[model samples]
Target chain A: EDKVVQSPLSLVVHEGDTVTLNCSYEVTNFRSLLWYKQEKKAPTFLFMLTSSGIEKKSGRLSSILDKKELFSILNITATQTGDSAVYLCAHLNDYKLSFGAGTTVTVRA
Target chain B: DAGITQSPRYKITETGRQVTLMCHQTWSHSYMFWYRQDLGHGLRLIYYSAAADITDKGEVPDGYVVSRSKTENFPLTLESATRSQTSVYFCASSERYGGRDGYTFGSGTRLTVV
Candidate 1:
């Protein structure tokens, strides 16, 4: 069975603070790791990491993957109230996705 | 619109009753998937289709049925609703399965079983 685990299930941070989310996975035929942000509705795509040590960034969010360690991390710098949402991690293998329980972040303004 | 859509944004059904959730994508992606999100489980795949008439089971598929007679539509049917089956259902599509680009998801349907 493929397993995906995320740490710090929930957190509360003030505006301008930096938060880091962690994800670790164990699976065969590994393809990629994906991150998503979910508010009250659907989850929107954040980033997809396929290579080791290569970071992908967009605006205030950044993510990197470490294939050898089988882990990935997402960083949100200068978080705002709008960044309060559940961060999800998924492992893509053999055309299927296995997701973690997710980390819920609450940004207080 | 131009993105994936799930109908019946919210639904309430009684136990033992049958209900079907509708999903449609205008992008014409080859892969479509059905998933359910719960408090602790996050998201779990129920079924998926590679194309029309190519449906397959996923992580949690029991008590659920799906058919894809058309490339743009995939519907999930619950033969008999159960309290445990109540959750937020989401429909997603991808032009290439497990490709560099990830799947695009719909707004989701909130189903409640009583």
Candidate 2:
């Protein structure tokens, strides 16, 4: 069984603050790590990290994967109210993708 | 719409009854997946299909069934619904194998069993 662990299940921060989310995984056939943001409906793709040390960024959101550490981190800079959502991290191993419990981020204006 | 779509945005069923959730994709992706979301569990895969007729089970497949008779459609069925099955169900599709390119998800269906 593949195991995924996310830190700080939930957090609250005011606008303009930066938030960092963490995810760790244990899998037999690692392929890539993915980040998703869910507001009230479907989850939207944020980033996919396949290599270590390199970071993927979009607007104020950025993420990086560490294959050696078996973990990944997602950072949100200058957060806004619109950034309040559940951040999910998933590990793609072979044909299956497993997700962690997710981090609920609440950005207050 | 050129994206994944899930039917019955919300559904309410009784225990012991059968319910089927429908999923469709307009991108003609080769891979489709079904997942359920519960509090504190994030999302757990129930089933997936590689093609029209190649379906496989995932981490939590018990009490659920899935079939992909067409390339664009993947439906999940609960032979005997239970309260424990009440959750938000999401359907997703990917264009390539292993979904290394990331998957596109539908709006999801909120199902409740009484």
Candidate 3:
């Protein structure tokens, strides 16, 4: 079975602080890694990392994949109170995605 | 106007009843997936379709059924609703395969079984 694990299930940080979320996986056929942010409703897409060492960035959020290490990390720089949400990591295959338990981030002002 | 949508944003049904959740996308995405979310379990895939009329089961498929007769529509049905089936069901679609672009999710349907 494909499995994805995330560390530090919950975290608290102050505004302007940087936070790093980790994700590791074990799958039969690995294709890519994805990150998502969920507030109260459906999850919104964050980043999709396919190659190693190449970081995908959008505003204050960035992510990188390490295929050799079988892991990925999502970093939030200069975080704001609006950045408080559950961050999810998923390992993708041709058919389905295996998701981690998710890291709940709480950013206080 | 060009995104995925789900109907019956909220539903309430009794145990042993039958219910169906609807999903439609306008992007002509080839892959559609159904997932259920709980408090701690995150999102667990219930079923997915590669294309029209080609459906496959996922991690949590029991007590559920799905059909993809068209590329833009995928509906999930609960044969016999149970208390354990109460969850927030989300519908997602991808342009290509699973690994290309990240999946686009619907607002989700909150189902309550009493």
Candidate 4:
């Protein structure tokens, strides 16, 4: 079965600290890796990485896919209170996605 | 604005009852999907349709049914509700295969089974 596992299930950090969330996957046909941030109602898209060693970034948030290592990492620099949320990582095959358990990060001011 | 939307943002039902969650996308995307969100599990796929009149089972399809008779509407029905089915449901759409482009999700529907 395809499996996606995330580490550091929960984290608490002070504002301006840097945080790293990890995700490892084992899928039949690896297509892509995606990241999302969920606040309350629904999850919002973050980044999608297909090629290994290439990093996708948006503002203070960035992600990189390591196909050779079968994992991905999400990094948040200069974290703020607003960055507190559940970060999800998913592995895609065909049109379906297998998601990790998710990492909850809480940034306190 | 053009995006996917789900009806019945919230629902409360009893076990053994029938419930249907509605999903519609104004963009007329070729692909639509249904997913259930539970605490700690993130989101799990329930069903998906590649186009009108085409549908397939996903990770968790038991006790659930889906139909896409039209390109814009994909509805998921719970034949017999169960307490375990109580969770947030989300609808997503994409113009292309989701592996590369990803998907756009609706606001989600919170279903509570009593």
Candidate 5:
């Protein structure tokens, strides 16, 4: 069975703090890893990491995949109140996606 | 523009009843998927369609049936609703299958079973 696990199920941080969320996976025919940010509604895409050691960045958020270690990490620097949400990580196989439990982040002022 | 939309954002059904959740996307993507999100579980795939007339089962599809008669529409029907099936259902579409690109998801539908 394909499985994905995320660390730090929940976190509380103040604004301007830096946080790192971890995701590890075990699946057959590994393809890519994706990150999403979910608020109250649907989840929105954040980053997609395919190659190892190569990082994908968007503003204060960035992610990198370590295929050899079978894991990935999402880094948020100088976090803001808007960054308080659930960060989801998914491992992609052929056409299926296995997601982790997600890390719920709460950013305080 | 509505990239993806799910109907009946919230619904309540009884066990043994049949319920169908609708998903529609205007992107004409080649891949569409149905997933259920629970409190503990982030997201679990129930079904996915590669294209029109081609549908496949995902991790959880025993009680669910899906049809893709049109590329833009993929609907999931629960033959018999159960308490365990109560969760938030999300529809997603991607330009291609098994690629690095991310998926576009709908707002989601919350279902409750009694």
Candidate 6:
């Protein structure tokens, strides 16, 4: 079975703080790893990492995949209230996605 | 209007009753999928269709049924609702199966079984 595990199940921090989320996966025929931010309804796309060492960044959020270690990390710098949400880590394997329990981050004002 | 949509944003039903969740996409994507989301489980695939009349089971397909007679529509039917079946269901569409671009998801339907 494909397994994806995320660390720091929950976190609370004030605005302007930097937080790092972790995700590790083990699966065959791995295609990519995707991150989704879930607030209330369906999750919205965040980032997709496919290569190792290469980083994908958007604004204050950045993510990198380490294929050799079978892990990935998402970093948020200068967090804001809007960044408070459940961060999901999903592995794309054989055209299917296996997701982790997710890290719930709460940004306090 | 241009994205995927799921009907009945919220529903409440009794156990053993039949319930159907509808999904429609205007993108004309070749691939469609149904997923259930719970607190502990982020998202689990229930069923997927590659095209019209072509459907397959996913990780959690039991107690559920799906049909894709039209390219833009894929409806998931639960023959008999159970208490454990209560969860938020999402519908997603993709131009290709597991394309690098990823899938586009609907707003989701929240189901409550009593």
Provide a comma-separated list of chain B TM-scores, one per candidate.
Answer: 0.97, 0.97, 0.97, 0.96, 0.96, 0.97
How many collisions per candidate? 0, 0, 0, 0, 0, 0
Per-candidate TM equals 0.98, 0.98, 0.97, 0.97, 0.97, 0.98
| Tens-place lDDT digits, model 4, residues A1-109 | 7899999999999999999999999999888888989888677889999899999889999999898999999999999999999998988788887888889999999
Give, for candidate 2 chain A, the lowest lDDT window spanning 10 residues: A90-99
**Residue A106 miss distance in model 2 (angstroms):** 0.3
RMSD of each: 0.7, 0.8, 1.1, 1.0, 1.0, 0.9
Model 2: DockQ vs. true structure:
0.85
TM-score of chain B of 6: 0.97
lDDT: worst 10-residue window of model 6 chain B:
B95-104
Mark the regions of model 6 whose C-alpha exceeds 4 Å error after superposition: none
What residue runs in model 1 are displaced by over 4 Å at the alpha carbon? none
DockQ of each: 0.81, 0.85, 0.79, 0.74, 0.85, 0.70
lDDT of 6 at A75: 99
Ranking by DockQ: 5, 2, 1, 3, 4, 6
**After superposition, candidate 5 runs with Cα above 4 Å error:** none
**Model 5 lDDT at residue B42:** 91
Candidate that scores best on lDDT:
1
The alpha-carbon lDDT assigned to residue B7 of candidate 5 equals 95
Model 6 achieves a DockQ score of 0.70
Per-residue accuracy of model 6 over A1-109 as CA lDDT, tens digit each: 8899999999999999999999999887788999989887778888989999999999999999999999999999999999999999999876578889999999999
Better of 4 and 6 by DockQ: 4
Off by over 4 Å in 3: none
Candidate 2: C-alpha RMSD after superposition: 0.8
True contacts kept of each: 0.76, 0.84, 0.80, 0.71, 0.89, 0.58
